[model samples]
Target: MINDIGDLLTNLLFATKKIIPVAIKQSIKDTIYALISIPKTKIYVFRLNKIISDHKKVKGYIIYPPTLDWDYMFQRPQQLARQFAKNGYLFFFCNKSYKSRGFKEVEPNIVTCGADTRKSLSAINDVIVYISWAGHINFFRKLKYTKLIYDYLDSLKVADSKGKGLFKKHIRLVANADLVLVTSDILHKKLLLEGRIKKTILVPNACDFKHFNIKKTINKNFEDINLIVNKNKPIIGYSGAFAEWFDYSLIKYCIKKRPNYEFVLLGATIGSSFHRSILDFPNVNYLGEKRYKVLPYYISCFDVAILPFKINDITRSTSPVKIFEYMASGKPVISTNLPECKKYKIILVSRGKKDFVNNIDRGLGLSRNKNYILKTQMLAKRNTWDKRFNLISKYL
Candidate 1:
């Protein structure tokens, strides 16, 4: 009878702990939204480059669609808004359906203009840069701008299968724009071949030197992991989605063969039968999804990082953000040889599972020389978001 009462008490406490926090969080969010108000603004930048220095004092707004919530990619809408606000740019985000409902009288500068607000883009008489492929085309067709720029950040066709149609639309948008900014040389070549002779520039992805300079200070979260790491034991790490494109079979093979080493997967596991099979491996450790800020900590724990992507059209025209992040971690990277990743000598390219295993061993055996670290840092510095945005600014 005493044991039953104790179990009941534990269950009640657990229930209360889970339920109370959710209700409290929702209440706080509502109160915060109600208390804060914004004024109407003159100019608006609709895309994600919220780090513009020139537009610090300019009266501008940002529009982020609700569609971003569909995928679990690294999205920081609130962060973007805050960054813009810090730089004196009025920031706002609205649901896609909000504008159509005529609920425009929320805030002046940071109004939640829904779908109907998009139509206002044409009459605003301000510069509008469309960042994504489909959204850029849709905005271009409707909105008139003093100077229009299409920031082709990725090859949509290779990024997702659903983006194939938008990829063609992006190509057309490239031809129509005043300036086109691409993120990869391979993509630049593809666009040029398709006759995109407009003011096109290649601006690769970038990292925050201050944030990613691991050599300066050891991140506290990583300090615990560092205690366990020894030169005698090699650690292989991969940080990203365990999506359909990820070669789990190759990962399994590597883990099976290299039983002595540890294989750590640090990311969200997609809900798929194939992904579930990865759990069967006793040597593999899935650290689950981590916050963006916490990622560098985990990455620093890795001896060698890997990009195990399957070769296909989806991967062919791709420029992965993880590649830059891996290099920024100052770890030797072994990637499956893909056309897009071939230009970087800092990465050891492999053809298949055999080559991947061999290269992983080679990378693990190599010394973490200062030359390699400097070379990796130089490459990462060149391909940062600031540089990418600067190239886009020229076209805008």
Candidate 2:
């Protein structure tokens, strides 16, 4: 009698001890499995659909750098890819670092592929967009596409030993590509001088105005902003990776020059000697990398934002996304005198260490310049991913 009572109670709770509908039992099993699983079994089912599902053939975009998802810092190629997906095109973003081998549909029209499927991309069709020239150039010939776009986002000169013959390879790739997009004026001029490709066009890096702008309301999710702002010191900020291109000596010089102001560096320390050593300084605050969604909140606390890049061949042709991001925050921006910075009226370009420090001081004073804010915000509004896609649609 005791065993029967215990079995009846257990069955009533689980709906498994007695006769029940197949769907109800299945739902209960699924609920139990979901509770125990890491990310839930349904997520795996959705990911598996990319490999087994019969997807319709449509216009496809295959981006080379593998960072196709929205998670990364939202670089130029990924931004454009998302825009294309929104406008009804199939997109495949390849990530060589991904542990899995198959492609998964992360969005409505966007599919992200892992390293296992790098060489097996026959499913996607149409546009092939190459962000750089260092990838396997020979394999490109095998892929059939209506258009091939080589977007020069970075200078290949700084690449490792594998990039030795890249100039010649780029010449060939440019010759083969239906359209060539250069991100900076320096790159545009260089391509023109080479005379290897005549169909090259300039499509500079742009801002996601909706995310980085000052007008956006801050909700409870932006708790980090409150913590940062509560510091109460005049904050001078830099957001992005601390790479070799970062001017460490200049940063150190500025820190010493402006001891009264708090200098904050936000982002990963990617093996840069200066970044590793600079934390020892008194006034410098090294806050590690923040997520992409919350970056605007952290940046909103900044009184003056900076782009202290070392001027070299690599940086000469660089079109930084941070300039627009900083501008969109409605904060004063002081940057190194890169060739591209000359085109923007809002940025205060510095010549050297003294100039950089002085400009930061000047920027702090001009934080409430409504005219300057309007100009930068207006410029940022015009230069967006939507506008860039409109230009790209011309060739497509």
Candidate 3:
């Protein structure tokens, strides 16, 4: 009886261990599915801005899937909505969560669908185009539209591990679109390789320079520097999301090699390990996240700025707004060698860790000149959001 009881106990323990791992794996899978489904669930906001403001009268309707509340994503839609309102066009934004947030009243031009079945979309004018994939796929496919535009912001298959299914959906949408607006040259090229016949246009990411340039001064007080480096020491700063594409390991190497320079990272921590490494560094200062308007002050404080992006599908196609912002601040810059940035000789490009270190050293040693400042300012002037919007306006 004792032997039989021991065998049963051992078998129970083995089963429990196996079951726990399976449960954990299933939980992770559910979380990832929820994240990916976000874009499908929230398609109303993006479409409304596109259709509302191009003309005095609303000619069409636009649709967008729900997107993550990243600063970059939210700011564009909000800005577009404001622009559309200024143009006096009817706009409607819909989301499943809007009702839960106590948003019941439909404002002048804006309509809130709340969590209603998307069947209401059928009543929308067939003269207007409908857009979206995945969650809105069935709706869009069934719609008979005058014109459809698919905005491909990123090549999801290559850029995100969890977005492979979404990428396939995008391909189908692209085939269905009357026009395809690609956000990167790389994405455009990829579509061309796939023999996509859609009318494709490249529209790189943009920044609101006027907003960033607000209340610019030669000086601003930052307290974080005193504990990490000398107050008057030359500051080399980087700001943005600390994601996997960021080469923090390269940053770590460079900071270790150069003790004289202060490295300021102004963004949320990506991982605990990265956060610990950065905080432990004597010369490194992590200032967490800051308001968008406050970024210019931090940029102004930097003697030089760095864009250390890891070479991946995401970074390869990425046209970082910070590059233009750094230029706008009239600070000399060093960045990793990226194809999109290769056209601009204004930025110092580094191939690897050794090259990055060397470039930063060179940039630090260079004398700041009025001519250099003026040139950078000129570049910044040309790259402003208004100019980019004008180019986009041509297509509209």
- Measured by lDDT, the strongest candidate is 2
Which residue pairs collide in model 3, if any?
42-65, 42-66, 43-64, 43-65, 47-62, 47-63
Of the candidates shown, which would achieve the greatest TM-score relative to the real structure? 2
Task: For model 3, state the Cα shift of residue 133 in Å.
Answer: 7.5
* Least accurate 10 contiguous residues by lDDT in model 1: 39-48
TM-score of 2: 0.81
Q: Write the per-residue lDDT of candidate 2 for residues 248-367, one digit (tens) a residue.
A: 889989988888888878886665444567888777878778987778878888889999999988899899888888888888889999988878867899999999999998899888
* Residue lDDT tens for model 1, 191-264: 88987756888765556554555752355555444544643477898988777678877888899889887787
Residue 219 error, candidate 3, Å:
8.4
For all candidates, the clash counts are 13, 2, 6
Q: After superposition, how far is residue 333 of candidate 2 from its true place, in Å?
A: 0.8
Q: What lDDT does model 1 reach?
A: 0.62
> Which model, 2 or 3, shows the larger lDDT?
2
The parts of candidate 2 lying over 4 Å away from their true place are: 1-70, 125-131, 161-163, 215-225, 272-274
Residue-level lDDT of model 3, residues 1-396, one tens digit each, is 234554565555566775667677556555555544555324333343343343336544544333322133234444443443344434344454533321122444444344442444444455334342333444465545566666666547343557776767777778777777676788789889999945877766656666655433544265554344446777888987787788878999999999888888887655543546567888888887877756777777777789988888777877777777788777777999887777688888999999998988777765267688668767877876666556655665
